[model samples]
Target: MLPLSDASVLVRRGDVPSTVLDDDLVMLDPLTGQYFSLNPVAAALWARLERPVPVGTLIAGLLEAYDGDPAIIAGETRAALTRLVDLGLLLVQPEQAE
Candidate 1:
């Protein structure tokens, strides 16, 4: 598994197709014939993932759009994105080390 940080770029898996109904996202991985759903917050993140997005961008957006502690938002987003990556619903582009 890859470590996802603020600099990591996240994008929806190209081979996977997704459907959105309200705030929920249903992802179907055709390769494995598996499907998964994301809740409202995760769904919103998924929508933004139509293109590659930096993890920091996501954290900043959530912080400004919602009322929550910054630390908590970052942690939760990282965890959720990790799971999505593991499930093959999302892809991660690791940040280049300086």
Candidate 2:
């Protein structure tokens, strides 16, 4: 995954009600009352968002989890992240000054 600006992601502890089912992450957002099922790839991405992980880090973690080619994973992750961002599931945090 390409590096995403920190200002583009927002996730909170209470935003999702998540459970692991058959090694998959199923999450429900109470605020939006939306239920989501995450595939292994998506689950890995979601897990990383528990904290403010860089998009590149998230992609690397997924590569480790699935042992797949980085290019394919990166493309897929970018699309998924975009969708999540558009869905308002994430709150963008402003980039911290170096």
Candidate 3:
């Protein structure tokens, strides 16, 4: 598993199928026939993964949009990203040539 960091860039897998129901989002992994559910907050985070974005940027955006504690928000965001990566629903972008 890739270690998530502030600079780690992440993007959702376009091939995976997903749908929003009510205030949550559900995704299906056809290979394993496993389905995953995301709460409103996680769903919001998923929406942002349409394009690659730095983990720090995601945390910053969440902090600005929510009234939660800074540390809690950052920690939860990182945890969520980690889970997504482990599930193969998200991808870590390889560093490009500088």
**What is residue 88's positional error in candidate 1, in angstroms?**
1.4
- State the displacement of the C-alpha of residue 2, model 2, in Å, after optimal TM-score superposition: 13
Q: Which of 1 and 2 is ahead in lDDT? A: 1
Best by lDDT: 3
Q: In model 1, what lDDT does residue 81 have?
A: 87
Q: What is the per-residue lDDT of model 1 for residues 12-78, given as tens digits with 9 covering 90 to 100? A: 8888877887768888889999878789888887888889899899888888988888889889988
TM-score-better candidate, 1 vs 3: 3
Q: Which stretches of candidate 1 lie over 4 Å from their true place?
A: 21-23, 94-98
TM-score of each: 0.85, 0.73, 0.93
Per-residue lDDT over 1-98 for candidate 2, one digit per residue giving the tens place of the 0 to 100 score: 33455244445344567898997888887877888788876876777787775666666677787767888877888788877776667545665666
Tens digits of per-residue lDDT, candidate 3, 1-98, equal 75687888999998889999887798998778899999999999999999999899999999999997899999999999999999888999986656
Residue 21 lDDT in candidate 2: 93
lDDT of 3: 0.91
Q: Model 3, 17: alpha-carbon shift in Å?
A: 1.3
RMSD of each candidate?
1.8, 3.4, 1.2
RMSD of 1: 1.8
The clash count of every prediction, one per candidate, is 0, 1, 0
lDDT minimum window of 10 residues, candidate 2? 1-10
Tell me the whole-model lDDT of each prediction, alpha carbons only: 0.84, 0.70, 0.91
